[model samples]
Target: MTTYFVGFFLGLHRICDQVMAIKRGNYRKKKVSSTSWKKQLKSWSIRIVVGFFALSIFWVLCLKFINPPITYLMIKRGFQWQSEGKGFKIEKDWLPYDDLSNNLKRAALAGEDAHFMSHNGFDTDAIKQALEKNQSGKPLRGGSTISQQVAKNVFLWPGRSWLRKGLETYFTFLIEIIWSKKRILEVYLNVIEMGQGVYGAEAASHYYFNKSAKSLTKKEAALIIAILPNPRQWDARRPSNYVNSRANNIVRYLSHYEIPD
Candidate 1:
């Protein structure tokens, strides 16, 4: 799988470089012959592709052991809030998989991805359902799995562009191949935005309930998970009727949720 991706990326990179070279008049300029340009482009492209692949692999491998201090989303949101003069400060604390409450994990699985333990990286059934709903003229929805969410939150920037989506898919496969399920869940809980300027289970627990994540009750965990769809818009600290209702639904679902061993 890794070899296939590397080869594909290299092929894509070579095509792009060739197009760029042509656009820059390498084919027209008498100083460089077409044959010479082709050889040079191939050589340089191979070198650049190898360098990028090595660096990417090294980075992903390192994350298996080292926790990231901050994510691109955190920095981007922080800058935006600062520009708006919202007095935003990122509050986050990294907790190991065992340190967080079981309810929180179960609640998250219940609220976000019910088949998280089974799905590889994408959830086909959820995607098919979303497509059907959209076709029926309902509001558009995403079928992004927990793995994809972690990929976007940890490595990629947010957007709906094809380029962004493609990169998200690439990273999703990488993490699923390299990191364990527990590690993926731990990273998701620790980095996912819970509220404005609040991140991670520990930070969210403290911000909303003034307690540690491990001490959160089932209801509290559900409430925290309820605002996940739009944490900035939904306030877990002062949950509206919709948020409260969603929390209740999540709690009910939690009873049937089985945490992956």
Candidate 2:
């Protein structure tokens, strides 16, 4: 142990000597100016930050508009005091466009954002309503579209924090400019959390229906859509009477709107 410590100290001393020599050589030679170093650092810093955000945005955009793997709903960390923290595993599964019915689409849209295709990215009217309701001591009206929700779920954390909202807004706009409407719907459907540890349509289908996402029925889809408000609290397969009524309402409302198609 004594010899090991002495050797370790000697190695550290040699490494320090090598670093000092390198610094001395740097001082002796013509070096990059501090201003230039700062500029370069700032440039690289911007590139790193922008690159990270841009790539995440692009991945979301492509996954939304194109047929690809659902990007956001996988659980990385387990639950603490919650219901034993549920997470999902994607093992060669894909949600086909045909498998999801129109009723399900409209129901999801109605449950999430009523005016999905009409707005750009931000739902200012809904935000205003949310704010107004908050002021008036009522329930908040969320104006977030499928894409905005995708942005929040995929890119940003779940919260009512100002910072998270700002970042979500930024990502929402970025994805709107990059992805199409169809892609947004696809991503939202596939990435939504259906239950504890249950994520994506495929995982939820397997957990709830014992089938694939593409084989899901209208009733099954309605049940899934019904629990969108709070997936963790309400089970989709065995929903309560209120959940059934809400699902029925979504189905009824869906008949009036042409959702996803």
**Which parts of model 1 have CA positions greater than 4 angstroms off?**
1-32, 135-140
Q: Lowest summed-lDDT stretch of 10 residues in model 2?
A: 77-86
Residue-wise C-alpha lDDT for candidate 1, range 1-261, written one tens digit per residue? 999999999999999999998878854675568678899999999999899778877877788899989998999889889999886679899988888999999998999998888888899999898888789766547898889999999888977777888888888888889988888888899999999889999999999999999888999999999999999999888999999999999998887987755
TM-score, candidate number 2: 0.70
List per-prediction Cα lDDT, in the order shown: 0.89, 0.73
Tens-digit lDDT string for candidate 2 (148-236): 88888767666677787888888888878887666677767777777766666777878888987766666777788788778879998
List the lowest-lDDT window of 10 residues for candidate 1.
26-35
CA lDDT for candidate 1:
0.89
The TM-scores, one per candidate, come to 0.83, 0.70
In TM-score terms, which candidate is top? Answer: 1
TM-score of 1: 0.83
Error of 2 at 179 (Å): 1.3
